[model samples]
Target: MLLGTPAAPADAAESSLFRGTRQFPETALWNDSADPAELVRSIGFGAVGATCNPVIAYTAISKHLDEWAPRIARIAAENPTWGESQIGWRAVEELSIQAAKLLEPAFQASGGRNGRLSVQTDPRLHRDADALVEQAVRFSLLAENIIVKIPATAVGIRAIEEATYRGVSINVTVSFTVPQAVQAAEAIERGLDRRAADGLPEREFGSVVTIMGGRLDDWLKQVASTQRLLIEPGYLDWAGVAALKRAYAIFQERGYRARVLSAAFRNGLQWSELLGGDLVVSPPFDWQLRINENELPVVRRIDVPVDERIIAELSKISDFCRAYEPDGMTVEEFDDFGATRATLRQFLDADAQLDALVRDILIPAP
Candidate 1:
C-alpha cells in the first residue's frame, strides 16, 4: 500500500451487465475519466481502472468547480512563485491522486496489474525525450497504481523505453496505427530487459498501450470527404474496429507483455467489437452509462475479423494502409501521421485551456 493514500473501499457489487461481461478475465472495463464522482459510479459498474489527459482534467475540474475552485485558489496562494501551467498541473496531480485512491481495492486485489489510473505527461514535452522521462517518473510516484501516459511519436518512443527502464509503468498514447503500437511495445520490452539485466524487480508494472481507434475513424472520414471518394455506406465506421482487431491479433501472435487498450470512443462498435481479447476498452463515463442503458449483451467478438471487402476498400486509402499494416510506418514517420498531428494539437490546446483556467483563478478579468 502507498503511504499517505487512503485504503480503498470494499468492492461494490458489479452491475448485471458488467458482471456478465467479466466472463472473460482477459477483457476488462476501465473508466476514461478522472472525476472521482464518475469513477465512484463506474466502480459500481465494474470499472477496474481509469485514464486522464489534459482535456479530462480540465473537464473534471470545470464540472466540480465548486469543490476545485477553492482548491485552485489555495494552490495558487501556496505556490505563489509558480506559473499557471505549474499550478494547473499541481491541480491535475491532486485530481489524479484522489482518483487513484479509489482504485486501490482493485489494485491490491489484482496485485497491481488491474487497478490503475493513467495520468498523461505534459503534451508540450512530446519532442523532448528527457523532459518526458522526467515527468513520467514524477507522475509514477504520485501513487502506487499510477500509470504514466506518453505519446508514441519519434522522441516519445525513446522516452517510453527510458521511463520504463526507470520503473514507471507507461501507457503509450497518441498512437493510432499498428506500427506505433508495435514500436512502443518493443521499446517497453527493451526497457524491461534493461531492468532485468540490472537486477531490478519488474513486479507491479502493469503497462498498457492505447490505440485511439475513434480518432482514426474521424480522420478517415475527413480524408474521404476532402478527396471526394464515393465510399460505400457504413464502411467508414469499421476503420478503427479493423485496426484494433489487427493490432490485437499481432499482440497475441507476438505475446507482447503490454496489453492493447482501445480508446477514443466514437461509436458502439468501439465497445462491442473489441470484447473478449486480453485488452482494455476504455470508454468515457457517459459512454459506459449509455452502453448500460442500451443493455448490449457482453459478447466475445475480439477475434471476429472484419469483412474482407471492407478491408480491401479501406486499404485503398494510403493513410489507412499506414495504420493497418505493421510495417507501413517507421518510427521516424510517427510524428507526421495525420492522426498523431491532430491528437497532439488537441492535447496541447487542452494544456493551454488548463493554464487559462488557473489564470482565471489567479488573475481575474476586470
Candidate 2:
C-alpha cells in the first residue's frame, strides 16, 4: 500500500489482468478477419501474446480480400501489389512478426522467456512428420521472439525435434494428455542434444506444450450420452492437471526447457493452480477479463514424475484409441457447410479494420 498515493480509482483494478502473475496470453484468433494490429492494440501491448492457427487463418481469408478501411488501411497504402493468397499468409507472417516486435521489450526483460507469440503449422499436415519439419523451418525463417506452434502428434513431435535442432522457438499445441506432453518434451531434448552434437548453441530453443483444457471438456461433452453410463458429470480428468505438472517437471529433470503452457482453458478455474514452469498460455479473452474482476490465483507446482515407466505406458497408439473412441458422429449429422460459411463471412465483412490490416501486414517491416 502506498502511503501517499491517492485512493484507488474505480477501474484501477482492471490493470491487474495486464500483468497478472499468471501469464494471461491467449489465442489471438487472427482469422476473425479483423486488423491484427488493431486487435493487438485493443488488447494492449503489456503481458500480451497471441496464438495462431490455420483454421482461424483460413477463416480470416474467407472474408478479408478487400482494400483497406480501418486502422489497417495505413499499411495497405504502402503496399498495394499483394494478392489474396499473399494477404492470407501475410496476415500470419505479419502478425507473428509484429506481435514479436510488440513484445520485444518483454522478451528482452525476461532474457528470452515469456512475451511470446505462437504461430501454428497447418493442422491438416499433422500426419506428415517430414513435411511438418519443413513447414516449421519455413515459418520460423528470419524471425526471432516467435514460437512456431506445432501439434503434439507423432508427425508434430518429429517437426518439434527438427525445429529445436535449428535453434527455433517452438510451441507445440493441441496437447491433450500427460504422455503427449512428455513425448513432446523428449523430442525437444533429442533435438537439443542433436544441436549440441553439431556444435551449435541450444539455449534459444523453447517448446511450449499446450494442454487443451476446454477442448477436452468439449470432447467429453460430445460423448455426454455414453458418458453418463461410462463416466461422471464433468467426468473430467483432474489427474490431467497432475499429469501436466509431472510432465513439466520431467522436461526440467531431463535438463531440457520445454515450457508447459496450459491451453484451451474454458474458465477461471485453471488460473487457481500455481503450476510451475517457464509460463502458461491461457485461452479466450473473457477469462483474462474475468481475472481482473477477481483476485489472481497463486499457481503452484505439483510434484509429479515423468519416468520411463510412465512414458512407456503412454506410447502405444492402440492404447490411446481405446481411451478416446471416435464414435461421435458423421458429416451428414451437421448443417450445410455453405450456409455456415455464408453466415461467418457476413459477420467478418462487418469488421472495417480487417482489410487494411491484411494489406499493411505484408509490406516489408521497417
Candidate 3:
C-alpha cells in the first residue's frame, strides 16, 4: 500500500500511518502541551511522551490556574519568602510534574525509551551554565522520567554536558542546523565519558536534539526574496527538511546517543519525508488532530539526497549554508548565527511574558 493511500476497514488498525510510525523504534510522539486534559487526549492517541515550555506553562497558569490551585497554593505556602518569579517557576514545574506522572507508566514500559516529559529551564539562564545545571538538577529530581530541556547554545551545551555527567537526561532545544546538532551530541558524549571515568554506571540516557524545521523555512522565506535566491515552488519549504536530513545522516554516521527530534513541522509533507527515521516528531496538538483525519502516505526521505542545485543556491547565503554543514561552524559561530540568535531572543521574550503573568498572579495590584 502506498503511504498516502487509505487503508481498508479491516486493515485500518494495522495500517494507520500514525500507529505504523509508532512501530518504528525511532518514531514516538512527544505531545507539545501543558494542559493535563490535552495531555491525556494525546496519550489516548498513543503519544509516548509530552513536552512543556515557558509559553505553554504561561498559558496553562493564565487560563487554567484554578485547575492547579491546590498545587500552586501548596508551593506558595511552603515558600513564604519566595517572590513572583520563584512561584512562577515552581508553578511551571508543577505542571510538568503532573504531566510526567501521566507518562510514568510509558516510561516504565519503554524501559526509559518513551514516556518522558520535558521541562525547560528558565530561558534567561540560557547563557548561564552554572544556573542551568542547578536548575536542571532540581528539575530532574521532580520525576525519574523528566527530561530537562536546555537551549542548544554554547553555554547551554556546557550545561548539557554537566547535566549528563550528573546523570540527568536532557532535551537540547532550538537546534536548527547540522553543526548545532553535532555539537550538542558531542557534548552529551563527553558527559557520558566523564561519568564513566568517575566509576558511575553508564546509565541509558534519554536525550533529544530538537531541530526546529518549520521556523527555518519561515526564516528562509523572509530572506529568499531579499537575497534573490532562486527557490523553486517545490523547494521553497524544503530548506528545513534538507537541513534535518543532513543532521540525521551525521547522527547515524557518528552513532550519537541522543535522538534527533524533528519539531515545529509546518505541514504533512514535512512529516511524510521524515517518517521511519531514528527521530521523534513533536507535532503540535492541532497537527496531531489533522494527521488523524487525513490519509497520508508514509514517505521516508532520510536516505534521499537533497537536490545539489538547491544546496548550491542556498550556499550563497552564509547563514543558510552554515546550517547545512555538519560541524563546519565553531561554537561561537553556531551560537551567533542569525536563526540561532533570533530563536534565543524569542525564548527570552516568552520568559519575560511569563514573568509578567506571574507578577499578576502573586502581586496583583488593588
Candidate 4:
C-alpha cells in the first residue's frame, strides 16, 4: 500500500476490540460520554469510566429533555434570582452526579484509579485561577469518584496545582502537546508535594493529563492547507499519534504519576497505537461503536514507533514542531496555541448553548 493510502478497516468478527483490550490491564478504556444510555452500553464493553464537559453535559441534558426540562425549570423557580448560566450549571452538576453513580462499582474495583467521572471546570473560568480552583474543589465534592478537569492553559496550570493541593483529583484537558502534558503533570506533582508537606491525610488521587492528539492533527491540517504546503493527508493523522507516543514515553522515563490520556481521537491509530501502555484512551461513544462494529485487532503497539518518514514530513509544520518537542511550547503560550483557542471556543459555545437551553424553559417566548 502507498504511504498515503488509508488503511483498510478491520473485518467484522466475533472478537471484540474493546473486550480484547482487557488483556492489557494497564491500558484502560473510558467512554467519552455522560449520557446514561451510552454509558451503560460502554460499561458493558469494558469501559470503567466516563467524562462530562460543557458539550457532553449539554448533550446528555438534550438527550433526556423529558426528564431534565422540568428539573431545569424547577431550579430556576427555586432560585428566583438565578439566571440561565447558574441554572444551567446546576443541571450540569446533576447530570454528572447521576453518571458518577454508575461507575461506583468500578471505582471501588480500581482502587480509585480507573472508574472516574471527569467533569470539566467551566471554560468561562479559564482566565481566573482562583475561580477555576474554587469550582474544581466544589466539583470534587459532587462524588467520591469524580475527577475535576482543568484546562492546560497558563491559569489552568496554576489551578491544577491548587486544586490538587486542595485534594481535588484532576484530569487536565484542552492539552494537545508533549510540553502541555509534562507541565500539567509537574504541576500536579507540585500540588501533591505541598499537600504532603502540610501533613494532610493520605487519599487516592486519580490525576490525568490529556493530550488532545486529534485536535493537534486538526490544527496542523489547517496550517498545512492555509500555508499551501503539499503533504500527504495520511501523514497528518500521524502527527497526534506521534505526539502522544512521545508524551507517554516521557511520562514513563520521568516517572510522572499522572497518567497520560489520549483524547479527541480521530482514527483507530490513536487507540491501537497506544495499546499496552499504562494510560487512558477515551473515545467518543460513536467511535467506540464503530471500532466494536469493525472488531479491529487488539495488538500491543504502544512501543511501536511511527514511520520515520511520516514524522519527518509532519515536522515541517511549525505548529507540529511545537507539539512534538517537549520544549516546543511554554506554559505561557498554551492559551494561544491554535488547538487551544479552537477547543476553548467550541467549549464556550457549548456553554452558551446550554444557557440558551435553560433560558427557553425559564422564559419562554410569548
Count of clashing residue pairs in every prediction: 0, 6, 4, 0
**Model 3 segments more than 4 A misplaced:** 1-17, 22-25, 69-74, 228-230
RMSD of model 2 against the true structure? 9.3
CA lDDT of each prediction against the hidden true structure: 0.88, 0.51, 0.78, 0.88
Scored by Cα lDDT, where does model 1 land?
Answer: 0.88
| Candidate 2, residue 30: how far the Cα is off, in Å | 15
Residue pairs whose backbone atoms clash in candidate 1: none
Q: Estimate each model's TM-score.
A: 0.95, 0.66, 0.90, 0.95
Question: How do all the candidates rank in terms of lDDT, highest first?
Answer: 1, 4, 3, 2
Q: If both were scored by TM-score, which would come out higher, candidate 1 or candidate 2?
A: 1
Off by over 4 Å in 4: 1-15
lDDT tens readout by residue for model 4, 1-366: 211112522232333444555577788889898887888777766788887678888988988899999999989889999989999999888888988999999999989998999999999999999999999999999999999999999999999999999999999999999999999999999999999999987777978899989999999999999999988769999999999999999999999879999889899888889889999989898888777666677888999999999988988899999999999989999989999999999999999999999988877899
TM accuracy, model 1: 0.95
lDDT (Cα, tens digit) per residue for candidate 2, span 1-366: 111113543224334344343242322111111235433532441344556555444444444545322324443455576564344455557656755666565556666665566677655465587777777887777356677877665556777888789777888765655556666777788888899899996465545776665554444444443434333333343323434555556655766576666665665545444234455645444455455556555333334343443333332222222222222112221112222233223324423233444444545357
lDDT of 1 by residue, 179-246 (tens): 99999999999999999999999696889989999999999989888898877889988999998899
Candidate 3 weakest ten by summed lDDT: 2-11
Better of 2 and 3 by lDDT: 3
